[model samples]
Target: MKKQITSVSLGQNAKMAAALYVVISLPIVLVLAAILAISGQAGQALVVLVATPVVYAGVAALGTLIGGWLYNVVAARVGGFEFTTAEVKAG
Candidate 1:
C-alpha cells in the first residue's frame, strides 16, 4: 500500500482549518441573511454585515464553533473540504 502525504505540513493546518471554516460559513450566512432579510431584522443586519467584512469574520467564528460541534454529533458524514493529506490517503 502507498502512503499518501499531506501537504499542510503542521502550522499551516491551523490556517487551513480557519480558511475552511470561513468557506463553510459563507453559504450558511447567505442563507441566514436571506431568511433574515425576508423577515426584516436579520436582512437589514445582513446587508450591513455583507457591506463589512467583519460580519463575515464573526459569522465564520460562530459557524466554526457550531460546525465543529455539529460535526461531532450530526454532520460527520456530510461531505466537505478535506485537507490534501486525506485525499491522497483515501485515493
Candidate 2:
C-alpha cells in the first residue's frame, strides 16, 4: 500500500527546529570564540561569538524550509515513504 502526505507545516517546523539547533550549538560556539580569543584573535572571536548563532539559525531555517518543500513535492508524486512493522516479544 502507498500513502500520501497532503501537507507540511514548513515554516513552523523549520523555525522551531532552527531555534532548537541554535540553543544546542550555543556552548560550542562559545568555546570556539574563547579559543580564538586565547589565540590572540579577539576581534574574530567577538565576531564568531556574536554572529555564529544568528547565521546558523538563519541557514537552518532556510534549509529546513527548502527541504520540507522538496519533500512535500516529491512525496506527493512518489507516494511518501514505505515502511513495515512486526511485533516483537521482549524476553
Candidate 3:
C-alpha cells in the first residue's frame, strides 16, 4: 500500500495553532499580563492579547508538524501503517 501525504489547512491550522498556544501559554499569559498590568504595563498586556492569535497560529502550525511527524514515525512502527494525502490530477 502507498503511504498517503498529510495536509493541513491554513485557517484550520491557525485556529488549532491558537488553541494549542493558549493551552500551552495559559499560565504564562495570565501571570505575565497580570504583572504587566499591575506594574502600569497594561499597554503591553493589551498588545500581547492582540498578538495572541498570531502567536497561537504559529504554535498550532508547529504542533501540527510535530503531531504528523510523530504519527508517521511511531504509528508505522506500532501499527504497521502510515498515511498520505497526495492527490493525483487527471488532465
**Candidates' TM-scores?**
0.41, 0.74, 0.47
Instruction: Specify the highest-TM-score model's number.
Output: 2
Question: Model 1, 1-91: lDDT tens per residue?
Answer: 3442222233344345656656766777677677777777864766644543454555555655665555544433554334343335553
Candidate 1 vs candidate 3, TM-score winner: 3
Candidate 3 lDDT, 1-91, residue by residue in tens: 3663444344565566667777877677777788889999999998876666567657677777776667657645666344556678999
lDDT tens per residue, model 2, 1-91: 4444556789997999789879977998999999999999999998998789888888889999998899889877776656555678999
Superposed model 3: Cα runs more than 4 Å off: 1-18, 66-91
The Cα local distance difference test for each model comes to 0.54, 0.85, 0.68
Ordered by lDDT, highest first, the candidates read: 2, 3, 1
Q: Which of the numbered candidates is closest to the native, going by highest lDDT?
A: 2
Candidate 3, run of 10 with poorest lDDT: 1-10
Model 1 residue 7 lDDT score: 27
For model 2, give the RMSD to the true fold. Answer: 3.2
Cα deviation of 27, candidate 2, in Å: 2.1
